[model samples]
Target: MSTATPPVSGKLFGLFCLASYLLSLSYGSTFLLSLLISSRGGNEHDAGSVISAAMLSTFAAVIVSGHLSDLLGAARSVALFGVLLVAASLGFALTPGFGHLLLLFGLLLGLGWGVFYTLGPIIVASLVTPTQRAKYFALLSGSMMTGIGSGPLLGRAASAFGYPVTAAFYLAALASLIGVLLFWRLDRQLKQAAVQTTAVSRISWRSAGQVLSSKAVFPIIMVGLGGCVFGGLSSFQTSYAAARSLDYSLFFLGFMSAAISGRMLIAGFVVKRDPFRASCLLSGLMLASIVMFGFVVDSGFTYLLAAVMLGVGYGLTYSVINGLAANEAPNGTTAQSLLLFSLSYFIGVFGFPLLAGKIIVEQGMGTLLLTVLAVASLNWLITVGRLIWRRLSTTRALQRA
Candidate 1:
């Protein structure tokens, strides 16, 4: 790989990471918008509907935007999405009515978020050697975590200062704009570097279908099943803490910090070795963690242990699956494969929360957790089964020889 393919400069890549962090910060503010809705005579139903809408938009955008990124070029696509993000953030700050917030937060912001995830990896892929991909992916994932972890804290601070909840949106808009400016500068720098670039294939329905149904892409999607397990945990951790008389903040702190650390520290090793084995091991840990959450209710120590276990497990899972997917990108179809990976991931992220929420209401936490356990256990079983089958086939071939 040439040294000048757009992402070589440490400063430019750092800026890209900053942009990712800011985009996620804006996304995190959406979690605090229920208060704004309540102040306007709206209810949790409205908030749920808005959130569901955003998830739907995010799903659709990931599918379409990846193809669009291929056609329009990564720099242009990212620029367009960044502009939409700026507009959405401003709308969030200025829109007073619940309906408008739905449009801005649900549809527009979701579009921007989808585009950001789709392009970030594709751009990074173009910039680095194959060996370095996993490390950078780990770094970008950490950047996103930084934004997610910090956004809520900032929202709390704004409330402490007697600022209306809308202030969070304003701050998000400012951060987003700064991120956009940095992206624009990076785009200019890429052009100035004069790297050889390939022309992306024009997208068609047939081409999209072929990419989606390709064998290389299937494992990538399967890897994303872990996200369903994670979404369930994220959606109910606060309630779980309350039920057990534990501190929600402390539980989350352990979970998110451990997840971030695992991605940064353990992901490189996983990607360098057998990703399937890593997947099986980490998923077993996730299953164990969920079991702890369900049955162990004695002390805060259990909460800490479960959260950290879950975090480290899923964190490594996230990085390994992404690195594996990126490795499968054939020539001009990198964006499309990544889109599938993101789509499968968000399906779990969005779908499982709703599923788990309903199950919790109808049955109980015990049943909901059992459901998570079943899904996670199945994931581990499939990976382990594949590994065993591969080893058996290799041994048979050796005997024949």
Candidate 2:
């Protein structure tokens, strides 16, 4: 009997292409979205509101996306969802004014992203073997980060290319269009028609309800809070750098490179060791990194060091949480659980950036960075509390035994 598993050459490649291209476009659209709002004569407050609204709407829809995905299969749902997002994104680009921007950001992006974000992971999980999951996930995450890190730069280049906001949308559309095609190709291979009926039969209300009520809920909620705090650091970083006479772009790029490398390296190691302990330690490291970011008085090397620390910390901590969330998923609640965890993160994403903006506007960017550090510290505290509880429980159980 052969113990070796076959490599997912054709199908997985197709899926990776889809994920990479789509996320790249999406990230570009993110930068363009911010710029578009600014170009339309909207102030910082208005921009924050628009972005926050889009994210909140996306978060709400993620719940539905997850449930529906398991009911349907992961691949078909993702394909259909991607197409809808393409249309919505294109429409947003074509629309004339801020009202149209509101319509797209508030509605289309939300619905589209909710579905896309929820299903993307499900599809990846479906395609790979359990043994390959760690490597696959790390690579997948790195690709998304690449897209994100390059997004604004691409958008700027696109704007320089002459389409202004329209160019960004076009780039985004092309990315999604490519994603749609890649998935469509893979759909031909991986999806089994006979299993569709069996898949639908597996869906259960009781299972979902049980999931809704669980001891794990509180811990999951903290993941969301941590996400917001992490995002807040990015929201305030550039502005903070300006105060310290830093080269913002260099510091930013250093963080991005470190983050990508960290995710790629740390993910495999964590899977080999104990995931639980690894994640908690990484989360603590992220908190420490934020503190480093907070106190950097020098712009030259110190700022770069701070960004790299933040990158490494987030790379390990945030990526591990994603894997843990996958492990925690219930039988039928694969998509739902995926979205639920993401839902919290996105909510934090939407709110925290705005919160940072408010602080920056009212007090200063330094205040906003402080806010991120404070939130990160809280995340560490919560993680430590959980660790302490676990140790105590283990001691008691051993004593009783």
Give each model's clash number: 0, 0
Q: Model 2 — TM-score against the truth?
A: 0.83
Candidate 2 overall lDDT versus native? 0.63
| Clashing residue pairs in candidate 1 (N, C-alpha, C atoms within 3 angstroms) | none
| lDDT for each residue of candidate 1 in 1-401, tens digit (9 for 90 to 100) | 44224346777778778878887777666655555565777654455455455567777677667567657666667667877677776776677767845654567767877778767776766666666777778878878876765655566678789998778778887887787777766775654542334355234566557666664464565656786887666655545655677765555577778877887777766778787788778878887888888787568887888889988887787777787776756666655666777767767765566567567656777888889888888877877886898799999999999
Worst 10 residues of 2 by lDDT: 193-202
TM-score of each: 0.84, 0.83
Alpha carbon deviation, residue 367, candidate 1 (Å) = 3.7
Task: List residue ranges in candidate 2 displaced over 4 A.
Answer: 1-7, 32-36, 67-72, 87-100, 129-132, 156-166, 192-209, 212-219, 235-248, 330-332
Predicted structure with the largest TM-score when compared to the true one: 1
RMSD of 2: 3.7
Question: Which candidate leads in lDDT?
Answer: 1
